[model samples]
Target: MTQVEARDSRGTEGSPDPESGTRRARVRRAVGALSRPGPWKRGRLLATPAALLGLLMLLHAHITDRGGLGSLVESMLPWFGVFVPVLLAGALWRRSASAVVALLLPVVVWLSLFGGLLVDKSHAGGDLTLVSHNVGAGNTDPAATARDLTASGADLLALEEITSQARGVYEQELAKTFPHHTVLGTVGLWSKLPLSDTRAVDIQQDVGPLGDAKSDDQKLPYNRALRTTVATDEGPLAVYVAHLGSVRVMPRNGFWTDSRDRNATALAKALATERNERVVLLGDLNGTMDDRAFAGITAQLHSVQDEAGNGFGFSWPAKFPVARIDQILVRGVEPESSWVLPATGSDHLPVAAGISW
Candidate 1:
């Protein structure tokens, strides 16, 4: 063979193939680009904020509620995810590898906290179907709201914010479908099964200074919660219907929740003493399950929506719901399905859940 042919057959001793050399150069360029100061440092502003967002979510429960700020944040915690995309866009625009990588922290934390809620976990059958609604006192058409509720085919219905004037309207409208019913002040429960041992639950009775100042006569008008026993085939089921006091944000008082928080505490005490093995609490609690104020209540009962619902099941401000303040919580039963009902005449939409004994 010729010298060139012989050399070619033997291959080059020290020289790499052109393709392999090109690959090595490309890899080195990539490594150098990533290792450079600019790529790592360009979006420090964005990266820091992204990391803080993740930390905020990771430690939201530890946040202080001295001025109700913690509850406010926890109430809207899920919405914080909206920032992820915004930060991601900024990272891409800045070509920031660090910023992009930082985003993974929040994304993972958010998914860890609320990812299961996004999936459809509802099942088909249940022993009971119950619905709860805060039929607004300002609702002009209680009759129409009653009609809409009856169409739900629920076995039990709990109504909150029932006005003195509309009590007769609801009682009359719902009597045919739900034969057994009780209305104690502003909250009421109507059931297809037998109801007994019904009593008004004074959620504001022990609300410290504010409660002490009010006389029994004065407090009667503000009674907005109740407890009752519904006789189901499975046995006596204890039911609590409540409309906790409203929260307000005033200029002087940061997120004012004194009334609601007190009411929640009183209601929790009532729940702790309950002797019934199976219990269901339905109402417009005026706060989400995540809020620390409901820690007492949430500790004993589990949210049906969280257990067996599709998505977040937001039910307030009927126009555009962003939170699941209207809740159906149960103890000693399995949640088969949970959902948000369509808007009625009230500002708040209804929420429903089906449970099996």
Candidate 2:
């Protein structure tokens, strides 16, 4: 044997294989890698605010309705979903995994509650079509607005905030198509079909907590509401047109003060006692469907747009509708489809609903 050959044999004997040593080095490197702190720590810290906000929004329903603010807030529950996108944008800007995950809480909550409403249930036809608009008291051009409304081809038209000055303009413009119509106070119902039993329903407005008894002369002709029955081919459909008391948010005062709350109660009472089986209430309700004050009405009647519409049919502030204060609520009638019509001269966009049966 050569001198080099003997030395090589000795070095190789009882030592680890090259492949085995390589594996050991790799295991050490992996261990070191696992021990290092990653971005998770920062992600979790940054997600804290979003997590708390999401939790609050998730339980918005259970939030105390002590102040008028809670009910008002719940009216816009779906709007809380807007926060999710904002948070997601922040997460992307900060590159936070946990923040993005935290947003799922509100996203899931909003979708879980209102997901069905987002679906499009519109159909091609319906038995009856109605349009409800709050043609603002200060509408610039009532005749033009009336012309636009008449063009929609609605069978029944309910108009609120119908000022005495503009009433003739609408009546003259709508007279051709809507021959059978009744105007009782600020609200009026114009129908293509015959109407009966039309009267100004006493919503018992809040004159004052302690004041002299108001007589017919002392009170406005129709303070806030009216009811009538329309003779439809389907059957006699009870119709109500109303402009509920306005709600105001003042700096010193609070939201949805007791006046609107009281009017809601009176309106609910009138509706509960309605003699007709099939009824439709159309007007500027001054409150969203989510407002607890309207629970009495909502329990009996459902919003057509909410149950069977493509999207949020916000009708107030025609320029940029944010909330659907104007409403078309129905009972014993199946809503085929619901939608908001294009803006007119009024502050509110006209909302319509088609129903069957």
Candidate 3:
């Protein structure tokens, strides 16, 4: 029990605990990390993906004519772009000054693409004014739709989904405004001026089971498109009124746009080969101009509403329009004014466009 033996025994019993020291060091390190800024790191992680998606959308619009997938992407991309700026702002909310600047990528993209669309209308000149409407297959009141269309005072009108049952009502109503008109299959046209050389443009191919139903009384739906020349104030303008293919959304099926895509291809091919330089295509199209299914039509003709309409201009359901399924498209004609008219007891609101050649 001497002093040296006592010290040695105490040292062995309570040597500086290596485990406790390591634990204390870890705690200090964690506290230091907590004191440091972290929001910026988190913000960068979120902002990068959003900024990239925004850029990809713009690039898609340029490199390829939007197909079905691209159109779906386009319609949704604007809302997505909105988040890019907001997320960037959030990244800066609790972080360093440099975080605010990170939003420039999305800011530039949004401004370059959508800013022009927001600007005040500048007059684009065209020679003739045209109107296009689907007129709705289940439209209960054809006369009302026709009268409303006549009131619009369009030089040329294209109608689609003109049911045989309602055809007479449309003709009777439209005859007062347009003396010259033509009806082929389920579509028809009325012109305040004159129309000529009417022909069915054969909008269908041997693709669907419905296509093979040749029986005169077969209760199957057949695909068809029509074309005619309207003698406008400008000149003879080739007017095509087409109901390409309807798209449906089902709970089980994602999106049914295949028929539409094929029909769009056919319509696009026909339009590309048209002899007339000044062409106008008007119809239901079963899709928005923003939709890729209408790329063939959009590529050939410019939407009057997208060019000149004031707002979202939704035209479906007549009562409330969520998406603009009805459209007025023109090639070689400048859209002067565009608007969706009031509903006329139909599922779709009548869309009108004033154009000059």
Candidate 4:
């Protein structure tokens, strides 16, 4: 064997016959390769899990409701950005340029979906002031609710879930600030300005699910919505105060009653035909503006809080809000500021917004 062959085979001098120097060299090279450490494979493993966590956060937004299975997770959607930035930081720590670059896609996706909200203001437009609330039907202190709502100093007030029994009490309590008022069954509208042509809007319900099925009440009608013309100083404005059907989560039945669905459709139709250019809609929709159930309303009017609200701005269970079922929506009017007021005797907190022409 040649000297080079012997060296390559044994990786040493004079180890044995037929050990060529070339073979010894090859052996030495193999030993050196085995002893050296490799690049960070563990880092690659972690990137996948971190990426998945980000995707799950986005999915949670679609199915989450205050009463739904992912309610808690949904409430936390605002904070997901904090985690996303951290995930990218992990990739940076691992010195994985590919994973780091990969994160930009998710970052872009999240930013596109929610980035607008991160801005300080919702939009730039002429301003109009309005307020909305769901005074509990079972509330015992109608006068107190009125007092609290009046103190909000809103230009227009829209109320919902008012019972027949408490109608007079509310009227008396709010008469000083809102002299112009109208009530259509359980729902009502009150305005600081003069109200004219006030009428009940039939929201496609013959009768809600709670009533007699065989009776005409069971048939869908459009009376669930109410509209009135307010003579503002600038010009006459059309206002709609509607209380869409309430949603429920039952153990045996999933989202049992859909009276609200029919009501929403009817409301949407009515809004579509509204001739007035400047329109304002306020009410307790029994669901969030983001919910697909309220698409009928969302498509027509823009929410004030979603545009300028600082936090989640939950208004239900006034004691501790986790979802904003009540809302103030406006079209052709600009909202300057929006916020939720302190709890009254009702189950929902009063929300108010300031606006200008």
Say which candidate scores most in lDDT: 1
- How far residue 61's Cα lies from its native spot in candidate 2, in Å, is 3.0
- Estimate every model's Cα lDDT from 0 to 1: 0.91, 0.82, 0.71, 0.73
The regions of model 2 sitting more than 4 angstroms off are: 1-39, 207-221
Across residues 126-241, which tens digit of lDDT does each residue of candidate 4 receive?
Answer: 34557787888889888988898888776688888787788889899999888788888767878878899898887865453343334434654234568999998889898898
What does the lDDT come to for candidate 4? 0.73
- Model 4: lDDT of residue 36: 57
- lDDT per residue for candidate 1 within 1-357, as digits (tens), equals 656533432237655578777888999999998887687888999999999999999999999987789989999999999999999999999999999999999999999989999999999999999999999999999999999999999899999999999999999999999999999888999999999999888787323223345432234346788999999889999999999877768565678687788889999999999999899999999999989899999999999999999999999889999998899999999999999999999999999999999
- Full-model lDDT, candidate 2: 0.82
Clashes (N, CA, C under 3 Å) per candidate = 0, 0, 8, 42
Better of 1 and 3 by lDDT: 1
Q: How do the predictions measure up, each by TM-score?
A: 0.86, 0.84, 0.75, 0.72
List residue ranges in candidate 3 displaced over 4 A. 1-34, 42-45, 59-69, 82-89, 92-102, 122-127, 205-223, 250-253, 290-295, 306-312, 317-320
Please give the range of 10 consecutive residues that has the lowest summed lDDT in model 3: 211-220
